[model samples]
Target: MHTCLAFFIIGFLVSTTNGFYSSSDDVIELDSSNFDRLVMQSSDLWFVEFYAPWCGHCQNLAPEWKRVATALKGSVKIGAVDADTHKSLGQQYGISGFPTIKIFGSNKRSPTNYQGGRTADAIVEQALSQLRTIANERLGKRTGGSSGGSSSSGSGEKDTIELTDSNFDSIVIDSEDMWLVEFMAPWCGHCKNLAPEWARAATELKGKVKLGVVDATVHTQLAQRYGVQGFPTIKFFPSGRKDGQAEEYDGGRTSSDIVAWALDKFQANVPAPDVLEITNQAILDDNCAEKQLCIISFLPNILDCQSACRNEHLTMLKNFAENYKRNRWGWLWVEAFRQQKLEDSVGIGGFGYPAQVAINARKGKYVVLKGAFSQMGISSFLKELSAGRLTSPLVPLNGVAEGKLPTIIDSEPWDGQDGTLDIVEDIDLSDINLDDDDSDKMKKVINYRCPKFFQNNFTLSMQSLSVYARLFARAISSTEAEHILFNGLLRLSSSSVHATQSSNSLAITYPSTAIKHAVHLVTVSSGYSSHDNNEYECITKTKRRNSLIEQKPHPSNVYGDDAFFITKHRLGDFLGVADGVGGWREHGIDPSLFSRSLMDACKSLIDNKLIDLNPLTLKELLSKGYKQLLEDKQCIIGSSTACIVALHNEERILHTANLGDSGFVVIRKNTIVHRSQEQQHYFNSPFQLAIHPTIKDPRLIADSPDLASVTSFDVEENDFIVIATDGLWDNLPDATILEEIKQIKVS
Candidate 1:
């Protein structure tokens, strides 16, 4: 037995190695015969391109296809087969075009086909979507079986269940299982789209539950019995002893939605079991209290269950539990699979694995540590729990404070309502001394700071300020003075912005004390833009506009200020960035102005004591910001992306508010501890809300436009928060920034 097992392992390794070589830099020419084996053998999802060598479009797409395939080699298996050589297979899949793409699953079932203009990214995305749908469908069926197992008739087959119109009476009504029956039309596009999912679900739940599809065109009686109003209607039959009368469930759902509904409904019918049966219930009962924060770990199996129970995550969980236990908050590890079974006995779909934590059960809030947990990851999780900030029900560890927090105001020159800036009168002539030309000075100022601010510390010595101003101007034009003030303030602010002993600091001096003390200059730049310049645009115009409009604020200026306060207040900090959309020059407004206005608005609010200091005050402030922008049309016209941060001293709270794509990332111990979710949207994005025609008010809701586009999160002391425009994010990954920030010694 041992020898056989060894031989099997060796064979598996050899096969993997062979596959690796075939997928290496040298593209292996594939034909029909090998394609099947390759697709069947891959553990990950596979995308196959069937193309004719002579087709023009196919020839044009060859290089792009190759690049995409090479890029997705490890995550997804990409293969191309010559259609001329695999004429039979191509014909089988109805491949009329020269280039056809299909996604094949691990089970070697019929592949999901794709047509039209094809690119590597497009193909990969499609394959992943299909894979997720397939996986979700399978998981749903498994969930349904254990929760609603009344329809089984001693069938052992995994994918096939015997269900006829005659037996439908006994199976659909009498049986205590949730039955999903699809009335499908053979030629219907919608039905065809749902076929693969239905079949997979049936196969997955074969013995535990029942699933059947009836061709509406062929089974007239079945259609009439269910009052089928559509060509493809699905009816769900709940499990029970209901005198064999079919319970009708409406259809017209995508396969995924259908499966999700079935699982939810089935689970709802069952009751949740007591926690004790799965493990030592007393352990959790003693440590965790209801309506309080508790970190629940998920143990899937025994191999790692023991280690997981005693792992570093557990240590942090224990510490948090001990600290917050007095608040009726605690932490405990629960086996996900075990809970799934227990919940099945009643009805709850368990989520997460290895180690998952529920912050506050009464609040229905939780966070899933999907992978192996570490000490730092656990600590980050605790901090988020303590703050009560989570964008989703699943709270992210080290999340930025959600909503708005009390803004730190140095001083207010005017009340925002009637505040007037005397641009000419306020201009300080002494602050504008220049030994260099305007252009040279602009270059020096704007180019002083690096584009990727989160990764670098901005520390400019007074002597180097002149040279730095020249560099800044050269790096960024059109708004050199603004850039100088912004970067300088950030450098100076960091020095005194200490929230905790481990917080980062920045200090700056503007030539003399009078220049620094008398005037408070705040410079804000727009986050990022999706629009590209047109052909009529001049090179210089494009360069200047793009540089100024697309520039993101230095991380030190945004999150650094928040971090400083988080440390000082003994709470987490909130920070964010916003990007503007539309043509910068064409819009007759600078994107930087929008950012500036927002920062100024926030500062003014803080200065006037208008901002609510408590944790709950965030939602209202965010609502106000959204409303103020919509009402102040002259201030902004084109769309903009925003991220906001809040810090609370008491309860050590940190929260963040966000809209559009400007992102907030949290890092702990050199790893990404949390990331905010982009607001839900379709082909178009919420980021484009500013420019969207129909969304005239552009508020969170029509009645509450002011608060429409906000999402928030919480934070921790050791957490490193990063808020950035898409420009910086496009070029760098979260992991890279985390590594850099980890190297920086916080003083």
Candidate 2:
């Protein structure tokens, strides 16, 4: 009996997999030339992996591929094509790499190419995900557009349809009624998984909707023509239209969502029920003795009011009637414009053609809605009537008497700082205290918000700056600060002024103080000027300082050429400067690179394992980093320099290295203490070793034996460290920098 059952299963598989392809336990092989025809005819989801036998990755993935194919054998059709043997077929699908998979679904014309890394598990996962989406879509269709619903089906032989780009139009568009087309690629893991679910849906919807598949690889032109940007893009097309030309509806990648959407659209196209129309007087005459709530539609012409006579409008009326039909609340509709008696009964002033509705049987009690009303809008009107606030015309409140206010005891206590107090009581007009701080006084006032202060300050500042700029006006470049101040002021107030009281006040206040302080600083400082005479002198001085600093040489005392040392202590840490590759002379290169590099490198060293008391490891790590920098591409064209130290407790260590120009110093007990001489030749001339063209060479890894000796030192805790790039070192004396650091610390 078991042997007979096995024979029966084999026979069933053989009978099902007939035609141009032959199915085995491992794979379904297709003739290269007839691949398109075979794929186009098959209804099941098809996944074909195009691979080169010689490819190592493909050979390694063969077993896993076979396992996946067997697992999805009954549900999906999996096949492999040897690209080397079928070069033309491979080229058709743009198979430039081996182990490329593509998927073909019922409504798809061509396969989509998978772009991620090729792996057996990745491919299987992708295929399964796609399949689930297609399954959900099919289930949605069978369930009458309702989500999470099931459908009854017959037990019958599974059905299949072959689809391709060439005949996709005939299968999807020109044929029967609704067609759901899935655009997919075999190489795509997503497409592969979608294949099984797509096949199941096709089988379920066999006679209802014509299903087809397109091999995206073999039909590149078709996929591109349809604007198939991504794989597993499924679209629904009504009968008698091409897939792309059909009204496009976005049914997210899920198959169930697509089916639900298709059902909804189809249902919408279904014919609506007929509407019943009656004269305006007929509605008024049939009213009850009690005040009846009526929905009166007014129109200037009978022909123009035909839309109101349609079932769509009647459906809305019927729905309203369902809730109020018992006359417990009373509901009726009248064509007020057509009937003179009804018109006189309701005071509708305009030619309300379309869907105008009014409530209340009495003329003056009605509310005229002069446009089409949606179901929700009509329902809302009915609800308002029930609430005793019928659709009455809006009346201006300008002359309305103010309502009485509660007694003072009933109300909350009046807080002095509350903004509402300003509305209740006017500000004291006689009090003018100019001596008080404006910001502090403003903060104390009622309705005084922070934003208002910012605005007030900004406005006052702009007024002052405008006067200053005109009085001390000079060339365009010199007025940069003024320009910045003006632009900043404009940015604050460009929005609608006074729209927001708090914002308006802020825009005018804070900037005013900032501008005043800036103007005062610029006016008082002798060094700052807008005149050409001072500007030229300033430029010259700056250029001279930069040149002098740029010419200074690296100290030879430091162990590694490009190294930064930071000494941490309780009082404050000492920072060392190390100028690395690239020089100040390079026009486009950043001169501050040395400063930034030293800070970053030292920060990393400190943050990592280097800050501990392991002196040997710290030194070794520092040396290794310097050597690595020399070998780096960036440092090849330039040299490096370093200065390191920190003062805390009663001890300190200061160390720095230099390659070109730049140095550092130490200040202990308020005395001038210089640790290393600036590597230079005489006063202005360059040093022999520094001037040498090979000084910046990457080959110069060892310490320079020709220069002045390298230096290092230990210092007291009270010592101050002054490390500077050439810009600061060359222009200012050591004592000056020490004093500056001390002042900065003190301040």
Candidate 3:
């Protein structure tokens, strides 16, 4: 048996020597001679993957690495080095694993490890993020700040200040700066919950109102002085008050609520904005050119509406201006027909008078108010605008991007008085209808033009309306048909012609519910791939990917003494591997059972949606999975090392948590760019999670789930991730593994 195993090992080594990829691939091949000249001092960002072609994880990552290189070809420099081939180069960087990725930013000497996912999208995203960081660093240096420090804009200033009894009086009580202080105990659960919210509010309110926190347990004197009796007690100190008692903070505990309450207090001290009339170009430019946003209202002409109505409208504007004083936004009003060009550009025509629009002059974009012109409606609109919920369409602000508003014809402002009507001295009594009833006049007009002009248009409109009504009814029954028809109607309504041939064409060409059902059946029968077949498409791609890389099932999901799981979920795709510690076998424990159970528990959590993807983290999954095993009815006695990688669906981010020797690597263009670091207390004993009924045995080593190393990065399409145990890693050399799979063509 020993001689047969020796022969098998020899055969494996001889097959993997030639490696998996070639120089013709998209990945730029780097070696000892070219590494320094091309990458070390270059201005462009470099993401280099050190890979051994023989590594199964490296082979798996080959396709994704090619994709990443192609996607970031022009923006970033993507390269690969065969660490197995170039022994000297690999040793310089301490490349001990199958694949390792390093990002050479502005500081090339200390290149950071790329911790993102193996997929192309995730890699590209993280590469871009790193690029941005490097750019921001250079920008800071040019603007008189140190590298990685705050720019001249002072964005790096800490928003939250820590206060002790010694400094609390000088910073909050005796100073002129306004402050909101929270006194809390460390042991309190409520305090821990409020900590993040307090920090968020502080960051948002930076450079304005100060937010501070005091540890009530540690700073007893400060807590007692304020009569703090709860886990979290908040107090507010107003500006310009010294030696005065702080007011109790009775507001919602959310970050937004805290921000709103503090902003209200801040705004109380600010003067309300003046509702200036757009009488000339200077008034419009001076008020709006620099502000964050400008709120413009088009009121009826003073002569047309008279004083009472115009003053009332102006009062409403003034009230809103005062309420939003904290924003320091510009407020302006225009009379109807005074700025006809502006009205046309802002889509204010046909919408009628008393129209309102919020414009970002800098962006040259505006959103119109479609709701009522009352206070509540306006408030809701403004709130949506503040929350970035409103979608603003792009508009030309008369060369706003060029630092100028469109030319405004000089006009007189409202003179705070009603105008007298200018009556004509001469009247044409010959055209008068003094004796005619209103019905008789309407009948005359209808008789003259209604039949000839309205006959065709009215008939067409009625026919189209009926068709739409029927389509809408059909849509209620069939969602897909309804969506297509409704979109068509919206397009027709938005176009210049409402009841034209386009509407007829749409009504004629749109598929019926029966036709849609037929098409769906045909699509399913013919295996036509659409976006709706995403799961099928992914599965097909995965199968094809596996077939292309290797002829043999090397790095199988399930291996001897090791187990793994790959699951696709709504949140993202998850890949995990566990290496059953061989030490458990000495005590007659089936090590594989423990590892397999742990992986199964983790997979079940993902399948059942037990792991919420909102702000998804891999550590939470691993910790929870372990907790589940501890609570299991059949307590398995064993230990294993674990590694988990997750790809978030929406963000395309890759999150990873690793414990012990079982690890993963990301390969790009035949090179290993990123690999997980091994965790070990000593030379051979790796960190692991274990379950044992009795804890009195000192011989059994059990590590907490929290001890797992967590990392997150960006990923993209076609990236490869290889997750496996130390068995494969410990036995195979990089070149031997590469040569074994080199013949397998990725279909």
Candidate 4:
């Protein structure tokens, strides 16, 4: 018997090295012909290794796989298939890498790829853990076999469960298993789009979780129970607690997302990270690695779990844990005060009590959870990760191609002074080119500090942020992009009269060689326009952008109503327009002051490249700015409509946030592609109805205008995004605007 056993072992080694592995009876050799028969039909859990014969990694894993198969023979099913020969089988399972291991859960349809360490021990450990979960589930099912389940049994029905008001309580409520149901209206467009995906997810998660659909229109009571406001609202009913307190699932609409969320919530049973867990080197080494993102949740305030934040912290952790079965991310929690190592690793132990940080051990990078630990915030964070929106590491000067890098030099830091000019009365204008002759000269727009009393400070101390201005000028060239033109000349009267307002408040003097004060407006002229009604037709000429300033501070300056705060703010490239409501003038209020105040608020907020840049954040930024403007002395009783356009050149995202009627447009190939919709109460009464008292008659009033129309669109290389106030949009039609654009010749 000993001799025979030795011979069998030798035979197994010989066959394994060959193309076939028939020597080992414990390891089931799978093929396209027998795959479904062995895997899909089997009741036990399966650990299938898909390997290519030519791959070196496959050869190394072969012996380890044999050991794993031998160790887990009776309780678990182990199988292997030569993926290179059975291309169809590999493609079905998405086997892009060699020696890919997959864990087939209780339901063979929903399989998870093994992202743990590539070792036999790790594989065995993960397999055993899953087996235990399956065992528990099966035991519970057997004990509760008498309980009536959904009439629409999850075993055979592969798609949506047709749920009505009559049978809703009986199956979903009485059953002790999770159910994902969609409340829908028959006529809804979004519901129609979601139908196929929902059906697919039901088929994928066949026996693991139950999926149901309700005709919300026909069943008003059921709809009201779940608070289904609109069409196709998806809600997840947690196992056993179907007291009608289902969670609303709102993230991605794909079938994969639905299935993933269900699996993450149900199958993952890992505990939240604590100081004990995070400090254990073994746990960190086992969990945190290249293929997985370790999300560390640290509660700073309380050491023990008995604190008030315990429940909230654990709930947030479980939310992250749901990602385990699908994405294989590590969800860790640590008490900040308990472990200084973990705290220092993620820069924690300040401010918020329970803080979360997502660290990518592979990339040596980490991202703090800046938003709340809620579904929307976590979803946004994960979405950004999948979309490659993580902050990129700064490249060193030497790392960049020598030819593409700009010259680096050290310069003296300028003093932080408020005054930029000596006197507000006298100024030089001869050297300041206001004509087409000096269109080729480089112009600068600088934002600086100045004393409140312009006449008091003679020699103003100011720092020149010329480096940013020069870089911005070089980036925005004539050939690549152009400042969107306005229908009328912006601030033509201001240039002619210095926009004195006749108040003699103070006539400010602008430096000849240099510009001193708030913002130095320079015009780089590319070419001329001859359209009859065109105020400023901004066209891109040679590769170099050399001309045109598009901001107008005074009301008579109708050429444009834009402000370039990007240079001074050092945030991002932004162009905005604010218009003084003409009706306010009839009420004895100088509407221009409110407009200027709004623009001033915008200037201050555009400081960081990331903040105040996103569509949602841009709306919030505008709201904050508007609120601040309302409290200002000049704008207390004044009302004005604002349209701001921020350009994220790095991300190539154009975020437009407008509170009132002032809008923008995107023209492509001589056609009006995108135009911001005018939000008017009636004919021409824009938002920002009033601040003093609610006026109802002569013009319609809306204290709030539908949450400021915020829109974001990805831009093409040379797409022109034009922003202007109602002065331009109300005056010219879209077709007329496109016609004017076609008139310009691309030189």
- Per TM-score, the best of the predicted structures is 3
Error of 4 at 131 (Å): 81
Better of 2 and 4 by TM-score: 4
Mind giving the per-residue lDDT tens digits that candidate 4 earns over 160-194? Answer: 67788999999898888788988877677556556
Question: Which candidate leads the pack in lDDT?
Answer: 3
| lDDT scores of the candidates, listed in order | 0.45, 0.42, 0.62, 0.53
Give the Cα-based TM-score of candidate 2 against the true structure: 0.21
- Give the backbone clash total of model 4: 18
Taking the tens digit of each residue's C-alpha lDDT, what string does model 2 give over 644-739? 433222334433343334455555555557645554321122221111122343333333312423444555444444444343332233332333
lDDT of 4 at 730: 33
Compute the lDDT of residue 579 as modeled in candidate 2: 43
Candidate order (lDDT) = 3, 4, 1, 2
- What TM-score does each of the candidates earn? 0.28, 0.21, 0.29, 0.28
Tens digits of per-residue lDDT for model 1 on 169-212? 66566767767776766667556555555655565455445677
Which segments of candidate 2 are over 4 A away from where they belong? 1-574, 580-599, 611-622, 634-637, 646-661, 681-714, 734-747
lDDT tens per residue, model 3, 483-526? 44334333222111221222222211111122121110000000
Better of 2 and 4 by lDDT: 4
Once superposed on the true structure, which residue ranges of model 3 sit more than 4 Å away at CA?
1-177, 180-207, 210-225, 228-234, 239-274, 319-328, 347-351, 375-384, 387-392, 397-403, 409-415, 422-747
